[model samples]
Target: MDTDLLRTFLEVNKTRHFGRAATNLYLTQSAVSFRIRQLEIKLRTPVFTRKRGNLRLTSAGEKFVPYAENILQTWGRARQDVALTDSYQQQLTVGATSLIWEINNTNEWLEQVEAIQPEWALRTESLNRQQIPSALLEKQVDIVLTSEPPKLADLQQVRLTNFVVVLVSNEPEQNMNTIIGLPLVYLDWGTRFAVEHSRIPALQRAPILHSHGCQPALKFLINRGGVGFLPLSIAQPWIDSCKLYFVKNSPIIQNELFMVWLSSNEKYEDISVLIDVFSETQNTC
Candidate 1:
């Protein structure tokens, strides 16, 4: 299988439009169409429908999508491993959600990595929760530390810690019930959080204000007087300092933090070292 063709297929699948996929892949639309046709010919099946301006995938495409993604991911990981071998000092690209950065002990994990493998160079980036899993699959990141583990095929997730998610409000008199009646601020990548909240019968009609980052959501809560969910680690200090208060007897949502990466890359020496370091740090935290 040609890796570039598979990548092109995945890109078209993601965008569901030839022109957009072409723009992203730096190819002309005609070239993108040709690649898709080539993939379809190789498989001896129609992958996409072309009628009525609809770009829907056929059944064959749906069935082949996951396998194509895995093949591309494996190839990318192999290339990265070979490239890392030339550096002598192993390079690990780590990604985390913005909420993780707010915790005081987050940097301690980085220091522990350096202590365990002094010859390894660590590259860290803060990504939105939605991007973490994709980053790992594309081999742009070696490990992703996130409060929520995304559901993706061929990935391994190790639980790092369990934390309580609490609803916080800046107003004193407002309780969870009253707050739910007003506009609520939510993180954009908070799928698990949104799913759990949607199950609450009491909040069925509540209006939501969506923000992409925790900082913006927090600021919105403070400045606009709304309720938002936050990690206890981040909200406790403010609660103690009388800066923020818990909104009523809201159910405490329990979230498990996970260190996720490709299982295929786990056998690599540098990844193993970093995993050990992260496991040790999680144990102590």
Candidate 2:
């Protein structure tokens, strides 16, 4: 089946109205209806119920959603794989959360991979924690770097390293009470950090600055002179430069980071080699 037909079906399914979907897809309403009719004819089943002002999917249509999505995803991955030039032996796509990229020196890791495996092409994507699991499962990414591993039977997780999040501020001489008086910049490390963070009453309150990852929180601390918890790896540079100071009395939370990929991946051995490079780099870091 043409992927365009699947695209039209999904768009109409999303909008639930042929006219709206047509407008969004930059096609005429009649064209959208034609595509849906073609899809139904191919499937030999009615995918949508034609009711005036009550557009909805038929039972089969609901079931077809995931299949259509999977087909498109597989098609996209295939395109990427086939697009590689003659110089490349294979492509490895690595997806990581922004914080993971920053703290783990992921760019350097990729550089190392390229140096050792000069024939391989490397691709990196910055994804959030929420998007990692589905990206891995759908073969959208070859590997994912994250702190919390998604609990899925088909995915394999490997521990990269453990990191400590320490409370740091510009004012090193300030005690806990004085530090608490300063604005707190909260960075969402992960579930484990949240659990450990709740134990500290001073860090429990609403933050003056909030971010999903380290860079924003780190920037806020440097520019605005607020206190926040950051991975030691990320905070070390500024701490060394006397830009940020460790809050000695604050609780330190340790979290393990992991890289995950599909267990059934075709390039399992090749992926393992890339991971070995990362592990070796981490050991030296």
Give the runs in model 2 whose Cα sits over 4 Å from its true position.
Answer: 1-79, 274-285
lDDT of 1 at 244: 78
lDDT of 1: 0.74
- Model 1, 161-202: lDDT tens digits are 666768788887666568756667765446787788787655
Best by TM-score: 2
Q: What is the C-alpha lDDT of each candidate?
A: 0.74, 0.83
RMSD of each: 6.4, 5.8
Top-lDDT candidate index: 2
Cα lDDT over the full model 2: 0.83
